[model samples]
Target chain A: MRHSLTLRIGPATFRIGSAWAQPIDQLARLYADYPDVDGAIADFTVRLQPTSAVRRWVRPSIFITGDHGLADAAPMSLAHGLLAAEMGMNLQMALGWRRHLLLHASSVEKDGRVLVMTGESGSGKSTLAAQLGERGWRLMGDEFALLDLDSGAILPFPRLVSLKNKAIDVIAGEVPAARMGPLLGATAKGDIRHMVPRADAVARMGEGGMPALLLFPRFGSGPAERPVGQGEVFMRLTQASTNYVALGEPGFAALTRFVAQVPARAIDFPSGEAAIAMVDRLWSEIA
Target chain B: MSAALLVMALRDPATTAALDATGWNSLIAMARAERLIGTLAFRLEGLGVPDAVRPILADTRDDAAREARQAIWEADRARAALAPIGLPVILLKGTAYAAAGLPAGRGRFIGDLDILVPRDRIDAAADALVAAGWEWVKEDPYDDAYYRQWMHELPPMIHAERDRMIDVHHTVLPLTARPTPDAAAMMADAVLITDGLYMLCAEDRVCHAAAHLLADGDLQGGLRNLWDIHCLCEESSERQDDFYLCLFEKAAHHQLTAAVWRALRLSHHLFDTEVKAYHVPIEVDYKLRWSDRAFISRLLARNGWGQETRKALVFAFFVRSHWLRMPPLMLARHLLTKWRKGHRPQ
Candidate 1:
């Protein structure tokens, strides 16, 4: 690696190395508010390497790799280097992290309790989490939600909330310009911009909140809510977790305990405002 | 170069206690690259590690345990699938290690299940497996024809429901390879492991691993393959008297004397495996042979970052693999076909 940077994201620190300086520079700008953990050993390392020697000069492809790698990962052009770095970090956590049962969900903390939203890729969880972050809810995380195995608390991951397509202008309207990263246009996922959580979220990232609500949010639907069954929740969560099968017995035990304790629902919304109002009602109704 | 620390950690786990954060990080990366993290997890069990590194190993141990179970379950599925055919099924390599409860199976990560059948029985066994829900993984006609014509195993098959792969072989090495091990003799000596499962005899098992490591492939991921030989030899030699004697005799009968000897010398060199047998010495030579040193460098080509450092030597060994598999004329034709088909080095 010719360039490198180390920064702490909530409880985990990442040491990102790259064959080029542009990606690291972009990451530094996006995560400027995050604490610098220079000289600290990182839990994961992400490398943005060139696909080959020729590729470094011609077409300049980036192969994202680290402690763990997916063999079928296609190389990205130099334009998407930052996205590649983020994916590399996510890949390492998905494959290697074991201190927590990781859930592919977004979460926000309020009054010492947490609300977790999970669904498929286009589920609008990121938009809701980002929107609520400004409306008095401290955004916990927008990507992976780290669940403590023993305590069942949701530890904050606090990565930048990546907004895509229409969600960009929606959240960009609320946050100040300095709080948002540059618009990355025409990515594989189409037009992504990263929004940093408020300063309080970064400052209190170490705090863990008890999981009080679990909702499966679906976007582009009529406003409706229904209770999700225990069996369905268990199966869906196992699928949502990248390391559930790898954790084996402890994973089974932790998930079983979690499903028993937490009440879950599937909520449908036509817009973010409607979703937020329903979420507020749901939160107050629970205990 | 980073392989030094990795080899030390594998050969003697106690020395790893002195490793610092940097040392442990590099060691773990190298082990993962070698696909021996599970083996290292087992080796470092009960040993103290840094605060942060503990969960990594613990998680790896759990993952390896899951892999072992899945491997055995796949083997069981094959057993039940092929029972009606009435042909013997012999487990090979990692699957055999796990089924026979060998030391090599401890924390072994098996990717696919390998089994052997008689040459005449292979077609029936393959058909039976397909009937049992195993589908051909290779869609390329050339690859399929290549496997059926020149390879030891049929084109790899993955179970439709389980998503695991199983390889059916009539013998250990490819038919085009120099040595022609008597597949029937090996099948005859297959000891019954369970109701419908069998593995090669003790001597044949070790020899087959040696031949596979040396003759069958480029010593890519050679560390784990060598570790298998080390654990197998260490266990069998301690428990069974005359184990080395039988190993050597089988090696000669299978025409794998050179491959087996090279395996022993390399394993003893890299891992200090104890091979106390007549006429088989691991004494360091003041003058090392060219081939001997090439094999050593080829095995240690990977750096701590899991990157292959020695490109020239790596390519040489890759060609050396195809060279060992077939004669020059056939090798040229095969290489051309593969190259023209847009097969680039991964």
Candidate 2:
């Protein structure tokens, strides 16, 4: 029942498991048009069976099976689609963590250092990261950035900067030849997303870069881009960070040390253009 | 002494039966060990509590007591490192039990340290902990978003290297409740010990505990509230009247009088504590509206209600009390706004 699907994230090729053998072949054929995908990992296997536990909040239209179990059981509803996507993303995060320190951040490379941009999802993190990546900066990751805890270095696990709605047009307009992945039907947030792969991500697979700066970016409807003060940055970053309290003494020490070594900034941009320009300036300074 | 005797006398056959069935001896033994460690904590430093309670410390035979003690020591070491940061490390609940000269393992079993810091300093606190080698327990994007957007506390952070866990609460209430008495005010009212950590005043602690019990509505939290009320009232006997009045004043100040009174009444009835003297000035009909008489009758029947009636009464009172707390006009306005915004009526 186990089947594999190769996903090219950054330069690394991860083979994903499908619970059934047939759909695995289907997915392989689906992506057969792309030649760059290297190899995949058989990490997950899904199944479809009649059980009270799997009963419909909604009945699915497409019943695709994978080596892991079921691929997209509930294909019709936006809620189910989001659930499936989240489940897949979670699987990737779990697998990725074993190989590297998976940070809850969005990242772009400046000079040799990775400028990690972290915020809650919908803080326009992926959009900003994608914009930076488009400006020739190496994209480390648009969702989670893998960091080496011991060395505080970021390892690239770049894939597509998953853009939704207007972001798709923005990215497409910016990079006309960018390949579009499958357009997921719909999501709770909006229509759906498929992203253009970051070229740098494909080139620098498994490569780790030192984490240079941490920035918390917010897009406001103002007229200018401003660098928020250090104290303000510290407060915002702290509020935004996960595991701040759990890290206890050592966690706090690591954060202070990390922040001291790297410049932490809160960038407020009025528009996407302003955001891209500000990041470009930061990239130049760091380089 | 009389209050303790009274608590001892009311111990019903059913109470004893339940306790015995649940291995109360071992639980008490664990509690006693924690109390012993609590005594040790005070002896090492007069962090809080009077010296008189120090002599009456009990003993325990439970192995979990040892594990709990080791955890306490580890936390103490971690607290020591954090003390120099000038932020008050207010040890909460189980840690407070140990620091306040009670048996460390006495009250309830605790898995890890629960500490409170000013919400503003939470980040700084995290940074300090990370430098000491603690790793985050789990990292998820949605979890980060949920904590940042909807929660008052960051996700529960566990030490990567040790068994210790720290729950950093920025606000005592959930974001949904929108409880008043902002973090700054609470921090301003905190009592700083010589060890450099602070403790919420008894008033705030009681209110916080009450809010938590009401929001969670579990048996254990109810039991804990009963224990806290009994302990705080008994231990602070000299200030008992003052404390009760202050508790009422503080609850009213925070617009939580209804929740506090409801929780107090329920805890009193459940534990057979004497609380009839405390009075609410509002008339029952005016307060509860539709079910005023029935609710009042049920409150009176607290002495002999069957388990089902007790449960129903608790739920009824909880709903009624919270409803009473809300301004009827505002509730109507909110409903109107929801309707205007195209929210379908359930």
Best DockQ among the predictions, by candidate number: 1
Model 1 misplaced stretches (Cα beyond 4 Å) = A10-13, A32-35, B277-288
lDDT of 2: 0.52
Cα-based lDDT at residue B87, candidate 1: 74
Provide the RMSD of all predictions against the true structure, rounded to 1 decimal.
2.4, 18.3
Please provide, for model 2 over B1-346, each residue's C-alpha lDDT reduced to its tens digit, 9 standing for 90 to 100. 0122112322232232333211322222222322222222222232332222222222112223444565567566567757667766776665565455443234344556767778778888887877776666657665576566656677777777665777777777656564564556667787754365566677776677666655433322234344565455444534575566677778887767776676566545444544435445432111223433343344332210001124465556555443433456654664576567675421
Instruction: Estimate every model's Cα lDDT from 0 to 1.
Output: 0.87, 0.52
lDDT, candidate 2, at B281: 47
TM-score of each candidate?
A: 0.95, 0.40
Interface RMSD for candidate number 1? Answer: 2.2
Please write out the lDDT profile of model 2 over residues A1-287, one tens digit for every residue. Answer: 13445555543333443333443453454334444544322222222221221433234322322222233244433223323433453444443223344456788886777888887766678888887777767777787776444576777766545676667677777765535555554564564454554545656666778877777777665434455566665565556544444334444555555566777666777778988777767766753
Tell me the spans in candidate 2 whose CA falls farther than 4 Å from its real position. A1-58, A61-83, A91-102, A176-178, A228-253, A285-287, B1-346
lDDT of 1 by residue, A111-182 (tens): 999999999888999999999999999999988898888888999999888899999999999999998887
The 10-residue segment of model 1 chain B with minimum total lDDT is B279-288
